[model samples]
Target chain A: MKKLMNDPERIVSSFLDGLVAANGTLIQRLEGTDVIVRRSSPPQKVGLVSGGGSGHEPAHAGYVGKGMLDAAVAGEVFTSPGADQFFAAIQAADQGEGVLLLIKNYNGDVMNGEMAQEMAEAEGIKTEMVIINDDVAVNDPDQRRGIAGTVLVQKITGALAETGASLQDAKRIAEKTVSRVRSMSVALTPCTLPAVAQPSFDLAEDEMEVGIGIHGERGMDRREVASSEKTAQLLLESVLKEIPSAAPLALLINGMGSTPLMEQHVFANDVIKQLDRDIQHTYVGDYMTSLDMAGVSLTLLAVDDELSSYLQAPVHTVQWTQC
Target chain B: MKKLMNDPERIVSSFLDGLVAANGTLIQRLEGTDVIVRRSSPPQKVGLVSGGGSGHEPAHAGYVGKGMLDAAVAGEVFTSPGADQFFAAIQAADQGEGVLLLIKNYNGDVMNGEMAQEMAEAEGIKTEMVIINDDVAVNDPDQRRGIAGTVLVQKITGALAETGASLQDAKRIAEKTVSRVRSMSVALTPCTLPAVAQPSFDLAEDEMEVGIGIHGERGMDRREVASSEKTAQLLLESVLKEIPSAAPLALLINGMGSTPLMEQHVFANDVIKQLDRDIQHTYVGDYMTSLDMAGVSLTLLAVDDELSSYLQAPVHTVQWTQC
Candidate 1:
């Protein structure tokens, strides 16, 4: 597992520096921290903040811009950020209005985000938090891990917050989005940490792990590698069965780190063909990723008028843009 | 190699179908061919057309939209499309004005593109062609392979054509861009074709291939894998030495296929630090890729004020957007 990095200890800082260097026009780093905020002047709206581990390159930072997250905190690779860093992000992102934290339902992330929210509230700043646990792969709904569906939550809530919505309204919408979306992934190969040369897990060339987690957690089942159509059917069926309604779907075909766009799009074609209902909006790319893991995830968001409009709304993020 | 595809024979068609399925709002497939054209009604401007082997996702097709390419013809994986397909692309793209073909300087592509231009001219559809040989790694300038720098050529010329430039002017600017840009790549691992079980090329755990082609063609040199900073210096030095002028530069840090964005950005950070000239533009991502190859390429386009404006102009393509 060779990496194009200088020092394993400096991977996160180098990544932040590189992102700002390439996109300084749209985003900037918070002076002495791993926090990235939009370069534009803070708008008088509810600030949206989301963050977690660092290996998912575009997940938390690539989305920091005008129409998405106001600020994103970064942790070390596959590790959660400390409470102080999240607090710093909240302070940087907040305008006159309050702040809303969109947290993925990982244990470390939730704990740190809660601690940061408490710190912000102590300083007389209004704050709210929404936990996203949309991964249907886990049978226990409360224990489900948030995966690619968190991106949809960010986009929809970010659009609402940009419209000067109140913190309560933003939290409500974020919660609704969390409840409405679900994701499931399949991994053909596991990822290795930048500091380590060994893969997180092992799989034979002819096998695949279904319902894999973004952090390289072992999936619920392993099976013989299937064709694109069958893989789509397997993931889509699991995702569809967990959705609460038959509303028009907003589909996201996300590439786990190393899968090519060619494979992602090919799988998306199969998923669209198998679904019977209307797909209001379609997003296909590496929106969220694990570190060089060769796999793909399918996220289905049941959208009505409001969610559909927000999903289609223009965004100026680096990874996921709509014009 | 385990691929997320149904059959090797159907890979190209499936890829095209998947692309159209996801981006139907912006692009559509030509009725009976593999050419992809914009979904919007044709504008009465010079049509810009480009194409090549199909393995490079988002290169020729991901660029077809309002401010980029008008049409893109697709070939099989790493195989050239026939002249007839290029002719169909020209016919579909041409409105009342003529069409300009952007050909990368591979022997098969040049021959096919030239034959297609002749065929279109015979049918009274006036056409012009520009060949891009920007890879400076090859010593013979005429024999140099066109690589990631072709994307910049497409972009600059596409923006010019969208402004209703005459076919002659579009061709002139396309040729100018071809002359101004240069590229070099480093591959840490080689990719495997969908139909074959063997890899394209092999590298020891500690080795890297420098100056590699976009296809699986071997590079000019091989060495022990170095740090991101050292890699950036090596590639930048080669690219800068060949550039003709000391004018501002537009840099593209392109991911070959499977290199993670985290690694790409880290490399971008190093490249920006080492380059001393004014970097007028910076694009970082998998713009043009070799299927599943883990590598990165650097492309530099020496830009003047005129070229910078076109480089920054808004484009609404599937893979790239500026709004």
Candidate 2:
């Protein structure tokens, strides 16, 4: 697939620069690094930091704003950032109250995030890390990868941190948020990396990849493409089986880059109709995306009063804004 | 270009139902019509309404909320909504106050909107209409089509109407807003309708359509696809030439559905770098789209003190919200 980029090597940096320029009032990029931080983080509050690969456009960076992440470190497309970059983000976000790291359950991200926490500690800053493994597609828990559910965790944890929670408190709440959320994706068409000339995977015109990874990794199963209703039912049943409780839920229908909002909504309608539960909140859009991958991911967060309130709290960011 | 829809004939209704389901707190559909209105429009305030074809996902519907549009009429995919549907929107939005229709400069939309206006008048409801022709791609004024710039006009005029401006005052400001905006688009790939087997237009692997319309219409020119920098330079130069004055600008980098946000931001960065004038606001996202066409459109709106203030006013809608 042809991309609208200049140099594939500089694509991530270019997107970050553009984002900071467009949202200069709310965010700023740390010079010489791929770390973007809130322009004015609340003083003496537990700072929130999250980072991962770059293809997820709004994932790590779009969540950096008021009432969300204090800093987001970006790596190259579909690749984790360096440990030093994560450490830089920790330093920038750390106040007197310490910092909390929300790491996705990818091997590189986990290793680098832990290394950054250590680096921050060596510099006399307190830090805590929470690993999110919300994808229920994989049968083995250890093999699960974090996906769109990370956004829900960010929203709740960021709001908790903004309320001046201690690092321990924020860490506990973030861990809870992570545990209660589950996500799975379906890819109708594979995404191509800017530097790559071919798509990540191939599918027949009538085929789809189910339980797909956000970084264009192949899914657990493949099937002939079905109607939106059937697709939503398949994803929802898989997600519901892994959910921990029958509590009120928050539904997120996330578009995989190239999926139209029209299709997302159609899929969402089918999902909502098939589900029989107390759904408190419904968000549909491209929250966490795989670059130009045409598909949708369903995220279900079992919510109680605490999680529900935080989800509804006012957040002003570039991609996800509620005011 | 396969879609995640059940029936092409029911796609519009399904999308509207899904939208209302997701954003029930903010907006609702008028019983049997494809008209979405704000949940509770302030009484005695001049109403703001906008609508067009259904493919522009957030354009007319996403703008319906507290400080923007009171109602949005949706037609089929790329087809104009019926005059009666628009009249339903007008009657529902009019809360003992006059209603203002913001019509895009399309032949069918203009005709249907005018018919709706007459129907409302016959029913003893006051109404006014403003036609927006912001696309500078067409050389002939009469042939221009309204595009993404319609979003800016909706924002400013919606805020104006909320301030209890008379219908005449609202129409005046709406016209002024329309006159100050200019937009141009470039498409890398064409979109296919859900029921159609072929794309609207075909492009060579390395070619792009310039000056493209939102309805998958053929562009005025075609050229080999270039780097993001070159593409932005071409679109920005065309837009700047048609801009009326040196007033500070509000820039909009709109993604034609299916264009990844990464590419959109990369394009936005290039556009911002090439512009030499003062820009007060920059919005980069899929504000308006042409189904799943892969492209980007740049909109430049000259803003004065009055326009700037209204543009920045707080609005609460499904697609756009500011506290």
Candidate 3:
């Protein structure tokens, strides 16, 4: 595969240099640290921080802004950020108020964010953490992996923090959102990592893998490609059956990476049809995307009035903006 | 080539049904029309409308909500919505105030949206239109093709409309945003249409195309695959050379459907590094994605104080929310 780098090993560092250069007014990087913080963070607002592997653009870092996360630590592609990096993010984002660490359910993410939280607490900062495990495609519900639903948790909890909600309140909201959300994905094709220059997995021309996790993790079943309608039905059914909520909901039809907006919208149309209840709102796009993999995921947040209102609150970020 | 559908022709309708089902409470469709509008749009607000081919997801439709677009008309995959569909969207979204149509500069989109505006005006509803031709990559500066920068036009204009800006005022803002914005894209691989089940263009394993447009449109040049850093440099250099602007800019590092977020972020870092001036904000992700095609685009919006403040304002939509 042809690529655009002088050295494969330095791609990540070089990319960071470019980001700092281009967005210096809004974002600042801590020297010798992978953490990026908003340049306009207020002095006393409780800080919200998040990070993970680097492949998900407009994610861990893109979300760092005024009303969302205060800082994001980025690791190399598909790898967890170091604990020290997470520590740096916490320090940069911390205001006089407390800080909240929003960790996804991936083992590396959980461990790294947790370790950072511990380190921050040791340094006399009041640090709280929430692990978002919202994916329903896993074999065991208790061990369900995190997927796109983490975005919702971050948005809701981030909105709370922006509104000066206490750290405990933000944690409560984050935990609640995570509990009420469920996500499942299907991959039409595997993506190639720039470093590897090969597909993560082999997919037959006529086949697809359903219930996939974000990192190209295999799901429970593999099958021949179905029509967009059938695929949407399958995904929606999985989410509805697992979420255990009978109230109004918010649906997210997210692209893993390479799926076009056309396919995602088509799939979203199908998923919406299968839903039997009134949906309070819906988000159909590549919100929590995988790297250039061709796939889509369905995320349902069974929301109450509070969550619904919070979901509608305004936020400002690089990729998403809402009032 | 396996796909899920009872019949290929029914794919669009079926998907629409599902979307309505999933967002019945937050949005509603014009009967017998492919237009989706927010459920709570008051009759007094000036409606902001945008639409185009279907491949761009979470775009015209996902943006329908408070502080964004009032309605989105969808066409078939990569095809412009029909005149009737655009007309329906206008009628459904129109309030007592006039409606503003933000049309991309594609031939079909402009023609169809124009027809819709005329029809709405004939029905005694005031309507205005602005054509977005922000892409600088196509080499025809005067007749430059509209590309991803259309999204920025939709956003700034939508914010104006939501804040009760007059239809003329919103049109002016939309036009100014388009005038000040520039975009360039590169495709690593051609995207396959679902119906065709093959790539739109043939790209060698080690080849890439620069200055590509959204709909498989030809680019300025095709070259062998380079490293991510070089690719970023090539794209950025082209954009900067074409449209020189001062510091404090809004940058969009967008993904073509199939490129992974890792690659997108990697490229974003490179572009950021090359930029010498202040960047007010940066948007990195798949904002205006092509179908499952592996590529990325860079968009620059020169940020004036008004544009920057407007960009910083809160917005809420299915795909994006900013507080």
Candidate 4:
């Protein structure tokens, strides 16, 4: 409860203000809504846009730049932006070529993105949608919540878009990337909401909640806390079962907020040590987060040569970038 | 007390292993030492080498790349690297143009850096040192512990070194940056050392430690918890007192390990709203950290045209990059 915020109700707006202030030259805020867009984009290329609740740092907003999201429509923490806001974002992101919306598989996000796409299409802006459902914890893929694999989706598609791919082509790549990536997360501690002064959930000192969703949704079960080695094995085992022989994949050891890079790196090392497949690349840091949750998630993206090229494409962004 | 580490005794080396696992292509680990060096460097350019402890990640190691430090030596958590390790870094970084060692002004760091400099000089590699003492919290500037401002010193000097500046020129610019920048920090909670089960210190529920050092060193005073506005005002006022009337300075709002980016951004917003001077630039996030400490430090680097140019210069590293 000792967070540095202005007013509980003002957390969303104030955080957006700070985002703009920190990267003013790189991003431009929409006049009214909680939206941030690239300062300038090529008019003849397909534009990319993605967004959701605000608590996940760098997920939607940090990807809004040259090689990733063209615009990000933000809602309150763990809440979706209004459909009208998403429509406005579509309008802002529509280059003459068209626009593609990257929506995570959350109910509110899906609804708003669908509505915005419809609205933009009616306005003759030519819009498409690619819903990402890469979380493997849920029994049904459609019901699975999107997690860190969403970044890989945005990244590969964004890089493809940077190559002047059409809306159809970018959407195709996005859908293909989505099919190849799978992610799962476990939380050692729960995050507190600004609107609520208490944590969303709690665990005992020696226990952890496994298979937890990003928004503190119920996971599979709770278990006694173990060494990072055991933790990495358990998380990776869940992911490896889906594609046992998918060698030469990219690994993303993402921190679910409040986990320091020291521990993230340690967990990453354990993941590598415990992995059975060949890793082409490993990304370690905070890409998506639950507000102050201290935990780590492992994401594996099955990358072929074409997907590898897209992953290697140079990107300049506020958060994720490559030289 | 839950962290994703194998053993507290081996955290330093294991963390370094993970760092290389994540960025193996960009760096190489020195044999038998806890030092990582950029794989390649321009032989004609002055090289930069920095090291202290393992906890302030992305500071020394994350900064090692084409346009930054050529080598970064890491030590045990909250401790200084051995003098031998620094010497190895200097040797690894020394090109024909010579090398410059950037050392923070902690007692252990300064002592080891000086010893390393002597060893490197005895071996006939041209070497110079610039000790960073930018903390405004401590009354005596010479004895002040270097904190986040040390990164500014590395970045500006690294950019200058990229321009093929001579050893003397790079050293001079680093010294100038160290003199111009001043910083202060406040912590809501104390960091727990991995080697120790308990926190370095304790704070009451309604209390905070102002001006705390990165390694949980005691600050000037402990006061009742204040709003982000009041906290920002107090930290900035202390930094501004040392550098009155200085405008157009780059602001670095750094997080101690466990603070969420959402809160950091909120704090950054408050800093802008409360600042009396016009800010030229603002960089926010966990550049330097105490191990899993929930707090922030504000660094103001007074910049003119030359310093501004260096700050804008393009560099590529694992953690930091400018497009």
Candidate 5:
């Protein structure tokens, strides 16, 4: 695959530099930290922090703004941010109100975010955390990995913090959202990192992998290509079964970077037809994406009044804005 | 290319069903109109409406929310929404405050949006428009096609409208933002439409097209693959020379879907190094994308106080919420 870069090793750093240059007013690099924080941070409220591997754009860092995260620690592509970076992000965003860390439930992410939280607590800044394991794809609920549903937690919890909800309350909301959401994904093709210069995995031209992870990890099942309706049904069935919802819910149809909007929309249609509930709200776009991999993921958030209202609230950021 | 769909013809309709199911509270589809509007129609304030083809996710629709657009009209994949759809969007969004149409410079988008504006005017519902022509890669300044910079115009103008700016004032702001913005894109590979079921174009393994349009249109020049830093320089040189600014600017590193965030960031880093002015804000994510095509685009908006403030203003929606 053709790529634009000086060297694979320099790719990430170069991109970070460009990002900093472009959003200098809104964000600044924490000295000695790979974290990016709002330039005017430590607002007079509780601090919120999130981070992970860097490939998921607009997720951890794109979320660092007024109504969302105060700081985002970024790691290399698909690699967890180091604990030191997370600690620095906490330090940068911390106000007297304390800090709350929003972590996805990946082994590396959970461990590193937890370590950073511990370090921040040791420094006398009270820190709390919510581990979001919202993906219902895994067989063991106890080991279910986090996926795109983590974004909903960020949105809800961030809005709560902006409205002066205490850190404890924010943590409560984050945890609540996580518990109420579930996601499943399927991959049509493997993505290649600029540095790696090879597909993450090999698939026959007619094959696809269901329940694939963001980092191109192995999934629950693999099969030949199926119709859009069938694929959508497959994903929805897996997600809905794991997090059965009787009440109104929110649905997110996310493209794994390389999937066309046409395909995503087609999948969304199938999901709606198959889902047997009142979907309160729907987000059909590339919200959480894998880089250049043709695939889609479905996230369903069982919405209560509070989560629904929060989801409807206004926010401002580069990647996503509500009115 | 592998895709998911039972019938290509049913794609748009089915996708709309799922979107409404998920975002029904904030947005509703205008029956038989192919338009999506804010749930609270006859918006309390001046209405903002923008749209084009369906492939560019989040541009025309993901933007419909509390602080931005009141409605968005969608057409078939890569096709402009019809005049009837645009008219329906206007009717749904228009209150006593009038409406403003933010249109890209594409031929079809401009014609159809203009026709709708005329129809609205005939109905005595005040209407205004700002045509965004921001692609610097297209050599002719007077006839440059609109590309991603139109997104900035939508955002800033939408924020202004939400803040109660008059339709005329909103149009002026939108026009100003459009004038101050420039964009250029490059494609490493062509996208395939599910209906067509073929690559948009044949790209050699090592080929790249610089200054490509969003709809898989050919760019100004085709060149062999270059280093990320070199590619960054080539793109920035054109944008900077065309836009010509010594002041800080808001930069967007947009993906045309298939390119991974790793590559986008690497390109962004190179862009920053080549920039001669301060970086005011940066959006490094897939704000607007072309289906599943593997490519990236760069957008620069020269920011003034008003534009920057508006850009930072709050918005609420399902796809994008910055808290």
Candidate 6:
């Protein structure tokens, strides 16, 4: 893989180093840990922490700010962070108000996050948690994988925390958002892990992978390569089939890196036209990306008055800002 | 070439439609021209107008706002806009104060922008022009190509225009910026034009093009693939050789689409470590991209008290923002 990196083994550490350096004004990495936290934290506000792997960037760490996540613990590319790091992030973000751990539903992530919660509680940190499983590609809700929908969770719940809400209140918002969000992606190309020179999976020139996961996880099926119209139809319909909402919603068209914004915009245009409900808000850009995978994912969140208020709230992060 | 697009002929039009639709709150397209204007323009300030080809999205269009260009005209992918559209942009952005035309130094863009300037004058609107040619790869200083350095010009000059400066003052700042800025790029993969299915050029697994242009034009030379450190060393040395400034400066590490943030961040990390002068500011991202080209370019603008003041001024647009 022709990637701009130093050593393959240093990808995660050096990336965090570069990220903290680039955005040092707003964020800082915890000393000797893989956790990133706000440069300065207000002690009385409820703390919110979310994280998963490193490859899906601008997701967990990029959301750290005053009105969003307080801290983000990063794992190796597509690998879950150890419990020790998660515990450290909780301690760094935790204030007198309490801490909330936002976990995506993956085996390693859930195990480590839960362990961190137990450890924090033993220290009387008053921490609670919410695990996101919003990807509808899988038939079982419990079996669903979390994808770009986690960003909506981060935004809405983080906004909730910004209001001086109690830990329970923040947990309630996370659960509410978890129930209303759905996401799925189609991959035109597979991304190779830096440590491994070859792509994780292979697709012929005339094929596409459907319902793919962020970590290059196998999708439900593969299909013939087709026009953008056909790709949008499949993803939009798959999302609708799983969770059809009659309420106004928010749409996020996320690029799996290497997909240009031009194509993302085209895919977003197709997605919105096929949606059946009123789109109260639309986010079309590269919010969360899988490393150099030329694909896009569609995320829909059912937004009522309350959800819309949180989504529209002011936020300033490195990769995202809405005034 | 694989891409997420509808009809090849309608790529530019549909992409603009999606852009306007997605960023409805920030920008709007003029009635029939390939021109984008701010949703609402404040008429008293000296208006800033810029246009060139499409594909380098979020460049001219995304910079349209209260503190930046009042309007931006776009042409087809890598193709200059027709004179008719440039004229329409001039008319749309013109206010009683005057209008400043920011043209990138390309034969077609220069010809069409100049034509539009004459047409605007015929209609009795005061107009000023600045053509930027900051690429150092071409030895002929008069014929050096314009690349990502134009964004710095737009930001600084546009900020000047926002301060209610006279047309003459804005023109002066643009000229000063053009003089101090120098840039060069390296491409790991070639970009394919939508109208044509093939990439502009070819590269083997172990080769890369140095000093490449935004439109995949020939660079200074090619060499076997090297480490990221080597890449940064070559680019930074080449830029220093041509411009060689002793003053503090701003650094921009721009990605030519398809390069991930992780890679961009790595490249930026390397660039900063090699620089000898004080870096007043650093911007690392996909500022001005060539369509799906897996590459990056480095731009250095020698900054003094005056230029630094304009560079740090707060301006919010769709793709970039600082509070």
Best by DockQ: 1
Any runs in candidate 6 off by more than 4 Å, and if so which?
Answer: B242-244
Specify the CAPRI tier of model 5: acceptable
- Which stretches of model 4 miss by more than 4 angstroms? B244-247
Question: Candidate 1, residues B150-262: lDDT per residue as tens digits?
Answer: 99999999888888899999999999888889999999999899889999889999999999998989899999999999999999899998886678999999999999999
Interface RMSD of each: 0.8, 0.7, 3.6, 1.0, 3.0, 1.2
- Quantify how close model 2 is to the true structure by its C-alpha RMSD in Å: 0.8
Model 5 agreement with the true structure over A1-323: per-residue lDDT tens digits: 67666877655566566566656666777777778787764357899999888766657776777677888888888889899989998888888798999888788988898898899889998899888887776888778878889888888887888887788898889988988899998998888776776899999988999988888999988999898778877887787776655768988888777666556766887788788788777777666767667888899998989999888776655445664
lDDT of 6 at A318: 71
Is model 3 an incorrect, acceptable, medium or high docking prediction?
A: acceptable
Q: What TM-score does each prediction get for chain A alone?
A: 0.98, 0.99, 0.95, 0.98, 0.95, 0.98
lDDT for each residue of candidate 6 in A185-268, tens digit (9 for 90 to 100): 989899989899899899887788899998899898998877888888888888876565578889899999898888888888
Determine the backbone clash count of candidate 3: 42
lDDT of 5 at A41: 45
Order of the predicted models by TM-score, top scorer first: 2, 1, 4, 6, 5, 3
Judged by lDDT, which candidate is best? 2
For residues A120-228, what per-residue lDDT tens digits would candidate 1 score against the true structure?
9899788999999988889998899989999999999998888889999999999999989999999999999999989999999999999999999989999999999
Q: Over the stretch B96-131, how does candidate 6's per-residue lDDT look in tens digits?
A: 887899999999999999998899999998998899
Query: Of 2 and 6, which scores higher on lDDT?
Result: 2
Estimated TM-score for each candidate: 0.99, 0.99, 0.84, 0.98, 0.84, 0.98
lDDT for each residue of candidate 3 in B1-323, tens digit (9 for 90 to 100): 43334465566655566566655666677777888888796558888988888666556676787778998988887899998888888888788788888888888888888888889989999998888887778667656877788777777877777777888888888888887888888898887666786778988997898888888887888888887778878878777765546647888888776665556666877777777767778776567867666788888888788888788776666655666
